[model samples]
Target: MQKFNVTPLLVMLGALGLTACGSSEQEEAPQSTKFSLGVSDAPVTEAAAVVVCFSGIQLVGNDQPPQSFTLGQDSSAADTNDLCRDAAGNVIPNTRGIDLLQLQGAASEALISNAEVAPGNYGQLRLDIAQGSYLQRLDGSRHPVQVPSNQLRLNGPTLSAGGTFSYTLEFDLRKALVDPVGIPGYFVKPTGLRLVDNSEIGHLEGLVAESFLINNQCNVNPADERAAVAAVYIYEGLDLPIAELADNGGTNTHQPYASTAVFFNNDATEYQYAIGYVDAGNYTVAISCDTTDDPENPDEVNFIVTKNITIEARQEPHQLDF
Candidate 1:
């Protein structure tokens, strides 16, 4: 119920060639290869539902300008669901963006299935999103979400002739949504996004006991605890200097890669956090619970701890406790 359909809008765009990828009128028809692109999301804590409505996906390579692919809505696939629809009451595909948060536990919704393209050195992949996408708050309120330029250009994986390439476009909602103070709605920043081979990423899940709080108290304000999780951050390198985290949770710097809010699961009795799609490499996990009252230099007196971990390609997420 979190997603809203914009099928007529998508069909309208496709008719105008606005979603078309290539425009070469005299280009020869080369033997096309197949590339399967899917979309997924890292867990976010700001809202109950993060819905994005995509209309088309375009693949750009060295041999061609770009090739457009239709996103049909099919629910049989693991990534496809009933969250989208067309005028005929059929589930639309890639054309309708999904609640990336809904496709979790390494699940990805297929964006392009067996998309045919000129086999060559593909450099970029572009995704076209509809203008109707919005975020649904926990209290059942909806707010308009902004997309930068209405498209995302990602580094594409190469597709060899007569071969197939598969990749998943992972959206990091924690870092992507900018909730500026005094701003009523959130803005979607695509720069924090990344595309990775489905086999080259790992999931990280961990637990934070209630005693993990700063001086036995949740550092979060009393009014902000209604959501499912508490704030937790992830960085790329080892331990990051306190100066790097000096900002008021601003992720303007490039050091911080992704973040997830830890959920206080009622059944588990612990704060559980999960990073659904992380590239295989070294990473530092940080949790900040203020132990001091200083607001300017909060990082100096917070119950912040960093854990260095190495993730292997396709390895099952191991529990990292604090």
Candidate 2:
């Protein structure tokens, strides 16, 4: 997968300062602005749950004191319900545990809502992740999921007064969540995490016909035991050469921006996948029957079906079926 250099993007965004229009004589600008932030995720295989405990969220900018919000302290923030706990099964205090799996495909839980912050160009937004974060396997075994330095820092958004700006941090777990060999736990890197303006984001969801999966020699029976299942890989831009399309990990000409597993929806009597919080644009979506994709290395996988789709903000979820 293509590795995104977040530093350059953050630097560029930090430089785009919001300028206010007023008289030549400078007047006191509004001291604070309303900002809201949430988080969403893409799916990962073999895991029943991926939970991360967040203690606080902070915004840092030049010439201003960093603004920090403690989870569960804000009345407007979503209730965490003590989702995090100690190894002894005691609930951890002042931390919000979020299961990324529960937030897949356009669904999100607010971390900060309607919070007041100094109106300015912030350079960094940091998440104080606690150490007890973990991942539960399908067999019910759990392993600690560690974040380097117990924090994640992303490019902060430029806030302005008189308006509430909303954003969602998209966690593409396929790239960010890693299971290291010889290690007892998983790790989360910053590569697959993207912070996007809510106004410019869209959602994608669709069905995968059983015949299509069978034709591709995919495992159509959800009840069958398997190493992995079928999945849909999404790439930025349209008409991307099939040869260039690559899965997570290693150097590649083109890498999937996000991917999700196709699961049988018994209630709907169909198989489908939903990808949420995607930036509005044209994209090429590929269906791969061989879904044993590893983010630590490149794999020779087959893409049996491909199609182009467009995502428009505020519109209904873009539906693409195979």
Q: TM-score for every candidate vs. truth?
A: 0.72, 0.88
Clash count, one per candidate: 12, 2
Scored by TM-score, the top model is 2
Model 1 per-residue lDDT tens digits across residues 1-322: 5986799888888876743544444254456787787787765654778888777777787876677765553322234345545446565555465887677546778777776667887788888865656788877898767677888888877777788777888787755766666876767776658788767788788887776664546632233443643555667776666456532244335345766566666655566667767788887777755312111122342436677888778757856787
Residues 38-138, model 2: lDDT tens digits: 99998887888899998898899857888888877866555656778888888888888999988988799889888877788899999999867999988
How much is the lDDT of residue 292 in candidate 1? Answer: 21
- All models: lDDT? 0.65, 0.84
User: In angstroms, how far off is 122's CA in candidate 2?
Assistant: 1.1
Model 1 stretches with alpha carbons more than 4 Å out: 1-32, 73-94, 180-184, 214-216, 219-228, 242-254, 290-303
* Candidate 2 RMSD to the real structure: 14.0
lDDT of 2: 0.84
